[model samples]
Target: MEETSSATMKAAVGKDYGEIRDMVEVVDDQPRPGTPREGYLVVKVLACALAPGDNRVLSGRTKMVQGPPAFPYVIGGDVCGVVHEVGENVEGFKPGDCVVARFFTAGPRGGLAEYYEVKATLTEHKPKTLTPVEAASLASSGTSAYIAVENTIKEGQSVLVLGGGGGVGTMLVQLAKRKKPSFLAVTTAAPKVVQDLGVADHVINYEQENWWEVAEITDQAPFDVIIDLGQGVSAWKVARKYNLLKSRGQFLTFVGDHHVLWAQGIFQIFQSMGPPLWRSAWTPCIPGVPTFRWQLDGLPDKREPLTNLFKLVDEGGLRVVLSNGSPFPFTTDGVQSAMEQLATRKAHGKVVVKVAEE
Candidate 1:
């Protein structure tokens, strides 16, 4: 081993919020791995997904970027990569394991790098049906939907997915059907895709502006279960329309922080009429049954939530849309166009960036 044993890595680095191309600089020799060198494992990052969050994190609109250990950060969350090196004392996973993960706290310095370190638990084996980029897209949206359906729902209940054409909505609409919900509906901006999935018994397009008039989801009045993984006010309005009291309904959304989630949970305690349930849901960092290939945070195989989901995908319960085209490459020059395209959300599915040839 060379004395210092420092290795070079490529990352999309930035100091300020701007277009991905304008701010990203590919510098050489930025050192391979950092401390916790004991538990840490370095992955040769392959493909990552682009979402609206990337724009927010990069532009500082989301206020998600934390202090220090910040800036010059790579802005990506959904990722899939092959194991290049493993820290000593780390067991279960070996070099070359391909894992999927969400680099939540780490940011660009996190998933977007050509190589990055991850705790073993966040990664899982890619579903056989998915490519790297498609698998990467599953972390936040796929798993959140999985958790929502499994945890909060019951069979023969009426369900609605607000902002239905989104990644989460796409998965939720399908997975919720697995429970044989009585009524399943999804709302989206795209009318055609809603028609194509056929998972939703009813589909409403928000683009029409008159969308709400026909969106009266129930003739009997209000849905039994509501999953709102979209905007906040929109969620509150829909909840008021369809939610029933004393019926034990489940509402899922991205609303609420640590405090808000607990507070909303309390309202469910006192109200006889269903007082709104503010869903503050997160994708599991752990793997579930059927065993995924990649493990981060801990042994990859040890995580149950992710592995369980894989089994579902394998069994045809969970579905991830694999978009056409090669993943956008992970180079400094190409990223500008990728980020610009990401902003448009014109692409039918999650945009992928291929970091390294696998």
Candidate 2:
């Protein structure tokens, strides 16, 4: 990696876990771009997005499945940028290549700065059609949704996506749409957006009425797959009570309960395979049900899944839906507003923060 003269870079620092305003501040003390170590590269971030997971960590609500982040952290994991520096041992990537990266598991402080350092394995070449902001918005959320669809959803199956207005939800809906499902439904506050965007065949306004009570939704029970992005207890209970899922159906959730995280973390402090072990061991025993959480720990490399996502985008088969009037400027105020909109749970598709000009 070549040297840059600048000694500091601007970053959004989380002083302590709390409110958005209290937690995040734009500061100039962040270290300048670093020389890449072996198998790593430094990126000049053009865009970074705010995911719900980012706020969960900022508010001290994250369950610490792997480990907790230190105080005064930098927040954000999704990044779309140009390779500014390449490590000695890296291959297939060089300086000036446009790439996308997901660093949620890397550490607490990540892409929400002028420059970010990440391993080569976690980065992917960006598709030509996607701008930096669009690519940033797709990183972690897109990868997870794509993998879930590939693993669980099948063509001609009926599908349900809870919380379909957010980042991962939007991607899940689009991926499922591509499969030509017999029936496709999504729970979102903004039904018009889903309809206008043609992302789902059925749109249930979760705010207007309970999902189970909606005749349009109840009529389509026993769906072959239900991807629960909302993680609402009531909705989960309703699905079980109404037999909304088929016998061989799959119910997958990435946002498991915080209590589960607490248990996982506490037990891990003593034994390595503790709560997560129990979860994996016991979840499959329930009679006549197929349920599983998105497994981040010990997961295989995401190259295949991410490559498929890029192909979808390049082929014009996938569309990224942004929240209404977004692509928020990269400023303290812009980031704060983005987090607040996500907290409202009414955002239409993903919310992205434009970090810098491409």
Q: Pick the candidate with the highest lDDT.
A: 2
Clashing pairs in 2: none
Candidate 1 structure quality by residue, lDDT tens digits, 1-358: 1112356666666657666767866555456665436766777777877665566566654342232255666667667888778787677777888887665362333677767787666667777877777778776556666766776668988776766666556777788888898777777776676667778788777666543356455452356666665544455454555442113444455432111221123343234112332121111222221100111111122346677777788777555654334377666766666667656654445567777666
| TM-scores of all predicted structures | 0.76, 0.88
lDDT (Cα, tens digit) per residue for candidate 2, span 1-358:
2223488778787788689987778777777756988878899998887777676677664445423456566778788899999998888898899999878363335788889997788788998898888888888788878888888888899998887877777788888888889999888887876777686878988888788777777788888888777654455567778989776577776654322233235544334334434544555687676564444423345566777789889989677888865788667888888888878767777888777888
Global CA lDDT computed for model 2: 0.75
For model 1, the stretches where C-alpha displacement exceeds 4 angstroms are 1-6, 25-29, 34-36, 62-68, 104-109, 209-211, 241-248, 255-302, 322-326, 345-348
lDDT of 1: 0.60
lDDT (Cα, 0-100) at 76 in candidate 2: 80
